[model samples]
Target: MAALAPTAQAGQGDESRLPKAHSWRQWLDREAWRKAIIAIPYLWLLFFFIAPFLIVLAISAGTSQVGIPPVIWKDTFPFGTFDNYVFLTQDDIYWQGYLNSLRNAAISTFFALLIGYPMALGIARASSTWRNVLLLLVILPFWTSFLLRVYAWIGLLGNTSWFNRGLTSILATFFPFWVTGDHIQMMNTNFAVVLGIVYSYLPFMILPLYATLEKLDRTLDEAAMDLGSKPWEVFKDITLPLSLPGIIAGAMLVFIPATGEYVIPSLMGRGDSPMIGRVLADEFFQNRDWPVASAVAVALLAVLVIPIMIYNFFQAREARRGST
Candidate 1:
């Protein structure tokens, strides 16, 4: 009985060491880890995106000076005059730059969507083995240097390049009296900028669309077909509605960056019609007008952020509806 009592007491001691009905400790530990994982992306945006934007906003409000940095030296605070923004309004070039950027970005995004939708649909409908190959093909250009790709286009679109020569031959063969020149003039035009943007950002459009289309319930499609619905009807009613999210996502991804793109515009665009990105570059580097560049950047951000906020709002509402 004495030995049995000691064993019973030892069992009680072990039970005491284990957690009781208050299991919140383990729950807290799990919640902590999950929250930490979720916080990583938010923290990254705060440090990299938001922080830099705030710094630029401060600089935009400051006065420009002749110095090493070329911006005013205000250490204690960041509040400054709105002279830079006023100056921006006084010139037509800044307004023109914004308009050109938006116009080019919109046109490029439209073309990308026009081309990408069919490609994405094909990939989504393809066999598993072929889908991967198609996706890889779509992204093959990214494997090469972006600058090289743009430069290659520059050669192809040049006045005397083979592409232009062959195009000229075709035109002359079809319409011999159209006064065809030696080669077409396609370079140093908005067309070239649009072409480069579409080529570079098409993958962004395709991947999102593929993801959305691939996940659509095939049974819905089959059921519609069973009900004597045609393929076009099924696609319009089922596929298009379901894929709107991906469409919006891809559009934002392509449009936002393309609006501020510097490389393609600077490399392929005419000097007379500079995009906002080129204007910003010239303001900062060539003109050494840091305050004005910062203001332009801040204005661009203001224009882009409104659409993003609207998107997020609609997305959050949809998520809540779905959850319910």
Candidate 2:
């Protein structure tokens, strides 16, 4: 305390201390601004996504009495019982529809994957311009109205329509034995529904596979070739393993929502060809049973959530394995 510090030492200490404080203050300001910016999107998602789901959850737990409102919740608790779920279990129609939806989705996803994989591979191997053009063609269908496309399929599959008529005429000319009667009715058949689902969801499968395949290392293929592996062998050993994530992702995308699809089935299937989506819709509108519809929806969500979670778990596991 009695001796004064050297001016040069004092100046150095002040310089270091001042800059550290200033930098920290600046960092705090930036962080505050960044947090403010982030808060906007977080708030928006909370209000939009979380709020709606909560409302649905609330409604699902409620019941519609004979004279009361459709959804009854008293004192912020679900006064209504689990009658909806019980009804669903008792109803053979609901169970049948659920199983049928799963079957249709699985079949449609299989076909979509079979067709889309080759298309995606072709696109990935093409030159940039050609790839872009092909991709445009793939997506071009979406530019038109979805309803119109479904309607067009109806026309194409109709017994007297150009497609079936042309096929019938050509087959009759070449091989009469192969050709059937005057009309070949594909409309209102399971085949038509499958076709519609595949057509609608094929692009979804293709684009993801293409993106993944395009980013894959060509060196892996070259190495497999150098190792005296055949093309199919190389694909099975190298390409397929590496592209598994994309394949799973694409399959999940097409399969999950397709299980609950309504529009395509309505357009192409018979009235009795009940899918979960159709049943859910009917419960809401035709039957005027909100609680039951909500229960059906919750069940659908539960079914989808399990597969999605499994897919995500596998994806994460793969990512961790890759990282290590």
Candidate 3:
């Protein structure tokens, strides 16, 4: 009886040592860890993204000068003048750059969508082993440096290059009247710029589309076919509707960066059709007009952000509807 009593007391002691029902403090502690995790990205954005933009906005409102940093901030609060922003309207080049950027980005995004949709659909429909292989092939170009790829395009489009030579040969054979002895002027044109953007941004378009399509319920497609809907009708009604999110995601991914792209346009575009990015570069680097460059950068962000915010609003609404 004495030994049994000690064992019972020991068992009670062990039970007491084990964790009890979580208290409010424990619950709060558990949530603190989650809050910490959530805070990391917000803190990063605060320091890196939002802070830099605020600095740029401040600089944009400043005066242009011949010194290092180039911007002269106001001594008083509000920190600078609105003259630089006003200049964006008065200066035809800056406004024209914005228009050219929008046009080029829109065209490039359309072509990227056209090319990428089929590739993404094919990947989604492929056997698992082949899907991975195909995806690898799509992303293989990224293994090499982006600059090298653009430079290779420069070589390909050059007058004496093999691509141009082959193209010229085909033209000469097919339509002798259109073919001149002079090489095809593929380099330093909007065609090259569009081509470069389409090629570079195509993967961005494909990956998101593939992700969405892969997640889609193929049973819905099969059911639609069973109901006597034609394959094209099924695609239009079932597949395309479900894939709109991916389409928007891919388009934004390609379009946003393409709008602000500097390297592709600089390497491939004519001087007359400078994109907003190139204008920003020339203003800051060549012309040493920091105020104007900062204003252009801020305006470009403002223009791009409106569409993004709209997309976010729609996406959130859709998510809520789906959850319900």
Q: Which candidate achieves the best TM-score against the true structure?
A: 3
| 1-60: candidate 2 lDDT, tens digit per residue | 435567657877578654555776886779878988999999999999778877776667
| Candidate 1 per-residue C-alpha lDDT over 223-321 given as tens digits, one digit per residue, 9 for 90 to 100 | 988998899999998899999988988888899999999999999998899999999999999998888999999999888898789979998999999
Q: What C-alpha lDDT, on a 0 to 100 scale, does residue 285 get in candidate 2?
A: 85
Output the better candidate (1/2) by lDDT: 1
Model 3, which residues run further than 4 Å from truth?
1-15, 20-29, 314-324
Model 1 pairs whose backbones collide: none
Top model number, lDDT: 3
What digit string (tens of lDDT, one per residue) describes model 3 on residues 42-107? 999999999999999988899987777677888888777999888999989989999989999999
How high is each candidate's TM-score? 0.89, 0.85, 0.90
State the C-alpha lDDT per candidate: 0.92, 0.87, 0.93
**TM-score-superior candidate, 2 or 3:** 3
Per-residue error for 267 in candidate 2, Å, reads: 1.3
Worst 10 residues of 3 by lDDT: 16-25
Compute the lDDT for candidate 3. Answer: 0.93
The positional error of residue 250 in candidate 2, measured at the CA in angstroms, is: 1.1
